[model samples]
Target: VLRNLAHNQRNHTSLIQAGAVEPLVAIMRNSWDAAPRINAAVAVACLVGHEEGNPRLQLDETLVDEILDVLDAACQGTMRHGSFWTVWKLCQGLASLTVNDKNKELITEKGGVNILNEVLHDSHYNNEAAHRYALSAIWNLAFNAASRLVILKTPGLVDSIRDIVHKSESIRTKEAAKGALWTLGLEQDVKSLSETMAQDAGWY
Candidate 1:
């Protein structure tokens, strides 16, 4: 019910005013069934996705942690399309809340960067859309110096991103990967590769 109501901005405002964050976080954290978890994640996303609502939602640190936990579990579990999309939405919601350095630090402290990196490396998923979302999450999280250092220091992260830029056929994936590398001061490497590929194709 709250999930449905969250689709409308006015209802979303009301739900937030009525203290919906705790119950939604509970459903996201405790629900055994995927359907409920997905719905709960979507509700949370709708609530935090708006600028007007982000301030209140950001005050609850546990809500962010629960969302990241659910997303990590879903990525490691069945990899069902619905589950993957729900997790993607959850990532999007986190990115939306990351309007400041403090929020980015909070997300990194909650293992958000590691979880997102894991999703990018999960070959079993093989879903381009999910990969794009994970890349976007990482990109958004790298908005601060501390978070950017975290991502750059992660083992094989730069290589993984390079592989995506060099190999991914999807333009969206390549663009997101490029954005991440650029954030980490690797734009020169990406440009060099682009030049190499262009020369190889005789486009130079």
Candidate 2:
């Protein structure tokens, strides 16, 4: 219900105005039910994605940690067969959280870069949406110095990303790969990176 409501930016603003962020955070913080927690997480992710000043001031590291735990569970296939959408949702959540400076550091501190990198590497054969989400998450994390260092430190991650950039035939995957590499400072200097999306390919 809440996730659908937050699908539109204007509706998300209205929901935020109606004090939705607090309860959504509470749900993610307290609910043991995966469905409720993921739903609330999507909603809060929308709020934090708002184009305003420091929207993440309303959030904290605990939220990113919680999202990562669920993401790891999804990657581990512990969530009702571990659907691709679930993994994508969690990765998307982490990507959004990286917009916050503190959350970016926390993501590396919490081992999120490796988690996303693992997804990127392992999903290369599957060509799932989660594959792209993992790439996007890695791209986002590369914006932070600490997180970028951790991503660079992750074995095979750089090779995987570089490989995707030159080998991926899918435009979506190739562009996302380029974005990740560009942010990681491996690609030749370029203008702003697009938040590329594709249902196929993986590298980080």
Candidate 3:
């Protein structure tokens, strides 16, 4: 019953906005099954939405930790593809909520920054779908001024974004990287790097 409510395509994502995420996450904690857990993560991601600003949905207080835990669990196994997709969705949703100092601080405290950087740097993360979504998440995070500043101050984000941009074949992925480069470079004081991108991509 609960599973179907979550898994059914007919199930409206709008429910989460009505404040349904807490119970669903509660169910996930007891399911002990990967499929249901994955669904829960997806649902929370759905609740988060993909826009650049904060959405109309409201997450439960534990929402962030629950999503992070699910993502953390997903990364410790052979289900990298599935886990990545789930995390990708999760990031898209969370990105919208992380526009403030407190949320950005919470995300870093939860280890999100390091995990995302790892995904961007991983050799196996080159496929178009994976690369596109993962890079998009990275770009979104970089769009947050505080987060972008933190990322630039992280010691390797510039090189990481540069490597991903030049190495990736997916136009979506490259464009995502370009967006991040544009945001961080210009809005965050990396304009020299942005000019470099303009030169390379012939954007004159």
Candidate 4:
């Protein structure tokens, strides 16, 4: 099953080489069943990045954009039969894709930041997983300067993330929320919180 494969990092290449990507995309785009759609998204997330420095998923620019588009559409509920779990899985895939630098830039250009921010405002799915992975996706996007500034400007987004940090019971979600806040709090400046502490300690 895709979920089992997702748990094992070693199977990533084997699955992709077997042409699992296209089918997975198809499921994410058109699966009438929410379970298949959600599983497909998680499988795609597992194939996302590796130590090779080239994304297993970002090999094609158009494919990357298409995935982002699916995610955006799914968030908006235009994609058929999408459930809260499906949206969460889609966010998980988006977060994983942001592991690649090029994907980060592409996602920003495709309005993925605004899309993720809207998840916080949408009342349709107050699902915890969706909120967590949305924060995680934004956390990854915050690594880029442009994305960070855009995130700051998005209405109520920063506050919504902070709310999650204080209220979420999931430690993973809280960590991601904190990570996004920390990254955005830099104000386009260099020095991280740890870096600032080290500098003050005269560690150089």
Candidate 5:
């Protein structure tokens, strides 16, 4: 109910005022069913997506971990697409939270980099939407130097971003990858890098 209503920006304020955050977090944490969890994630994303709701969402210290746990469970479960969408929305929400250093540190402490990198590496799923969302989330986290360093430490993350920037037809994905690499100080010359990657992939 709150999930559906939160789509409107005006209603986001109402929902937050109605104290939807705590119950939504609980849904993410306790819902054994995938559908409700996914919906709850979407609702949370929509709510926190509004500037006003960010502080309120951040008030729940356990929210980040709960969202990550939901993401993890979704990835491991049978509802692949649902989980992917859930991750996408969750990433959007988390991206907004990066303005706070504590939130950034909490995300990293809760293994966010590895989880997002794993999503990026899951080629078997052939999920470009998920990849783009994961990239956006990573890009958001990369805004912090410490988080950027943590991401760069992840094995093959830079390579993965490079591949996405060079090979992905989606400009959004390419741009997000570029932003992430730029933050990590990995995007030296995009033209040269793309050319090199294309040559290696025989696209040139």
Candidate 6:
């Protein structure tokens, strides 16, 4: 079922838009077993950030938080890609639900900043598709929530982001970093990030 959904690009997205998302959200909410839930989470992620809206599911306020909880649990596990993908989707959904500042605070409050930092630094997850989605989600949040407070609050965040921006050859990673840096801007934090970027520019 997952293969069919994942492989057929058009049909896969169509189901999500057609109200299958609520069931996926339910799976995440009730399932204690991680793998099935992870699969469901991944499916949920595939729907997130798409340009479709489901008016029926609009009343479910718990949707975003439930998805985020699953993603958070997945992160604590060893399966990096699946969990990371879940987070990427949740971030997209959250972006859809709230404005930039609200989303930023929600991401930060949910410890998304730390999770993104870890994923960015984890060499193993870098090449995975799920990780790419995670990076994009982080990029969106960083750009939306770019401010001095997030930088100051999340220790090692600035440096980790700088390393990815300057050192990685992957254009996706670089672009994600750029979104983050663009958020950081020419503020005093730039001095520190710039130094790290220069030092690590050739490492990756």
Best by lDDT: 1
> Sorted by TM-score, highest first, which candidate order results?
2, 1, 5, 4, 3, 6
Candidate 5's TM-score: 0.69
Task: List the global CA lDDT of all models.
Answer: 0.71, 0.68, 0.56, 0.70, 0.70, 0.53
Q: How far does residue 59 in candidate 6 sit from its true spot (Å)?
A: 11
Output candidate 3 Cα RMSD. 5.8
lDDT for each residue of candidate 3 in 1-204, tens digit (9 for 90 to 100): 333354333565656555677766665455555555545645644454443353333333354565566555444434532443344444444544454335556666666666666555553422455445555655666756667777777667667777666666666777777787777764443455557767888999
Q: What ordering of candidates by lDDT runs from best to worst?
A: 1, 5, 4, 2, 3, 6
State the lDDT of candidate 5 residue by residue for 1-204, as single tens digits: 677686556887778888997898687667776567656756776677445335434423455666676666556543443444345555555555554556677888888888888777775243676787788778777877788889989998889988888788898888888887887777675666777877987986
Between candidates 1 and 2, the one scoring higher on lDDT is 1
The whole-model C-alpha lDDT of candidate 2 against the native structure comes to 0.68
Against the hidden reference, what TM-scores do the models get? Answer: 0.70, 0.71, 0.59, 0.66, 0.69, 0.57
The total of clashing pairs for model 2 equals: 0
Give the distance in Å from residue 186's predicted Cα in candidate 3 to where it truly belongs: 5.0
Ranking 2 against 4 by lDDT, winner: 4
Candidate number with the higher lDDT (3 or 6):
3
User: For model 5, where is the 10-residue window of minimal lDDT?
Assistant: 52-61
The TM-score of candidate 3 is 0.59
| Model 1 lowest lDDT segment of ten | 51-60
Q: What is the lDDT of residue 24 in candidate 2?
A: 83
What's the alpha carbon RMSD for model 6? 6.2
Worst 10 residues of 2 by lDDT: 190-199
Query: What are the runs in model 5 whose C-alpha is more than 4 Å off?
Result: 4-42, 48-53, 59-61, 78-85, 123-126, 189-191, 194-204
Q: How far does residue 22 in candidate 1 sit from its true spot (Å)? A: 13
Candidate 1 TM-score, true structure as reference: 0.70
Top-TM-score structure, candidate number: 2
RMSD to the true structure for each prediction, in A, is: 5.6, 6.5, 5.8, 6.9, 5.3, 6.2
Candidate 2 local lDDT, 169-201, one digit each (tens): 677776777788888887552232221222232
